[model samples]
Target: MRRTFLTSMALSMGLAAGVAQAQEKSLTLCWAAWDPANALTELSRDFTARTGIAMNFEFVPWTSFADRFLNELNSRGKLCDLMIGDSQWLGLAAENGHYVKLNDFFEKEGIDINDFLPATVYNYSTWPKGSPNYWALPAMGDALAWVYRKDWFARPELREAFRKEYGRELAPPRTWDELMEVAKFFTGREIDGKVRYGVAIYTERGSEGITMGVTSALYPWGFRYQDPEQPYRMEGFVNSPEAVEALEAYKALYECCTPPGHSDAYMVANLDAYKSGQVAMQMNWFAFFPGILKDEQVGEVSGFFVNPRQNEEASVLGGQGISVVSYSDKKDLALQYIKWFAQPEVQQKWWALGGYSAHRAVLEAPDFPESAPFAGDFLEAMSNVRDFWQEPEYAELLQAMQRRIHDYVVADKGTAKEALDKLIQDWTEIFEDAGKL
Candidate 1:
């Protein structure tokens, strides 16, 4: 009788262990370390509370973020069960099967991709640009937007001076020419009894910072990476006279209007300059706007604008999408996390938590545009967001642009035409090597 009782106890223990193992599923998500990522970590507590699955995160700084995460993806590392990768990485991640296709899961879960903002759905989630080959979910909808000191713009004397000099109201600029004029007007000037520069445009020498910043102006000025119809015929398009002029304008803004040492500024530095009252205007991602609104020094005086236009309005698209790593043993759990994240309530909380949700439901909420100082500009900017290359060789293409543009813009090593001409040559060679030309 004692032997039989011991056998029953051991069987019950083994079954309980199996059930515990099944219910204890967990996942690790990796993303760039920023304010949004911190917010996400806080918001993810809800997911844990509801599902009982554990969540782990790896937050890497923006500078070496791509290098660290890409290496993990390339090696099929199980370290990251999920990743919030840049939109431009979609092409390579999908082509190499580093990401699990989310189409079937979306359909099965009844998560309508249409619920996301159209631009974000196209740029962040789709792999082939316009196709429905979904490999990720639009997590953050971002665009390059402007922040300026409204108190200065509203000053009667400054307004009169600006109107006298430029023959227009000193409101947020509507064109790149006006933007430059605004920048020029404020540089080295005393405002509120403190000297400040005109703007802090991205001129970082490393990585894709310069390209991302310049393209905000370039797209409206008629720069094209390649022939839209032929895709790889980039020679005349990338090096067009209009593109050269745009590059020249970008360099001019950086050299004459920005503060000293801004040649190395990127997102964080630009934000710091604005927060510290060192610049009258700064260009940054919409993701940073909430923090700016919370700032004590600049918040009360801050103003926001969509990217200024030349021939047409355009802003650089800046955001990432959440993806399930293809090699993840916890893919099902990761997918559950994404599904939970895609819900409307979660998206609303995402916004409340400092993440810029791409969900149309949240964005289209009647009060959304007026919810924050920059919300309207965010909506307007998304309407005309332009993206860089989404090719499998995008990193290589981006690196080449970084080198070419930084050398010309920051180092003043070449003319705008020379810089763009060299860029065209570099892109052509890249395509040729990839057998696309």
Candidate 2:
């Protein structure tokens, strides 16, 4: 969902040294500049102090992270020694031989692989399963979940009104239909004398914001980006009859319920609106939840819930684990740092620093602060999360799907079927060209 993962054997980087490398090898790393990245950077500083390996981070803007990493890695440029790429980049990086295997390192450090959530570790670690090697340990686990203004929803009059209107009591929604109903319920509702919208969704096109935001909704309606018969191939699900039905439902939900200029919404936009008390419920990634506690204005009353789906099985695929580049000169040091970070104490530190933990035990830790408010809900949802594109051409395939979703949600250029059909054609062509069809 955000910038980008694994593999086997004792693969060693080319090395010739009679040289006393500086007390610490200065390794350059790149990752997104969001709160989680900040949290990890703090951990990296601790790493620097101990090993004198001197890790330096380059915080790239999400806007151009892909192009920037590509320009560097493709040219064998030295700008980045270790990079945290978007999830979609995993297959490409692995295929391109840009990552080092980590299984040996884990064993050498005496770190138990089972300590991590298999869902988070397996996909990000290995290129193809059954390989004894791995690429990256999942640096963080992420999923889509919603948080709401409990105070407003709990008001006696509002609950009665919702009960009358929907034939049920007001509680966090359990289905897409209920999501719409609740979003509509609070869209123009006044609370504490301020007008508020019901929900905030990301629609921006700069990167993959639109897709990242919509995939959670898309999966629940029996929407599949591709036919299962083929690998690395996508169908025109975005514009399919079912997908269209979902999109129509989405259009109605957003049109009737979101704040002004919401058509331009992105993660930060939604966060800003929710923080400002301009929306009653907002869906976002977990990393931003801690900020609510510090923002003060809307911090005191927000409650959390898992996103609802039409099917009882929740429909969402979250972001993935991070990896070290195989091409880096500092593989040994990078492995060392990841080992330190994998321990329970370090992961707990990551959570306290507002970093989303891909380590399940740390997230589910019983003593997790209630002060942060939404921590319990997030840990619970993390257990059931999924990730998309278990194929090699994952990035290009994802881009194609986003293009079709954009057409349905933004351009209004054609029916969801028409747009999705085109995407399927486009994706099929790519697969055919790659001999994956």
Number of the top TM-score candidate? 1
The regions of model 1 sitting more than 4 angstroms off are 1-24
Model 2, residue 294: distance off in Å is: 2.2
Alpha-carbon shift of residue 242 in model 2 (angstroms)? 3.7
Residue range 88-177, candidate 1, lDDT tens digits: 999999999999999999999999999999899999989788898999999988999899998988999999998999898998988999
Candidate 1: C-alpha RMSD after superposition: 3.2
Candidate 1 backbone overlaps, count? 0
List, residue by residue over 1-437, the lDDT tens digit for candidate 2. Answer: 12210111112211223123543477787887787787788877877788778778888776677778866767766667677775556667777777666777778888776777776666666667436466777777777888888888889999999999989999888888998999998888888799889999877776777776776676677777656675444544445677767767776676789898888677788888888889988888877777766667877788887778685445344555666676677777777777778888888788778887777677556676463677766666666665666556766776776777777777677765676678778778777887877
In order, the Cα lDDT scores of the candidates are: 0.90, 0.73
TM-score of 2: 0.87
Model 2: residues >4 Å from true position, as ranges? 1-24, 129-133, 229-241, 364-372
| Candidate 1 collision pairs | none
The alpha-carbon RMSD values of the candidates against the true structure, listed in the order shown, are: 3.2, 9.3
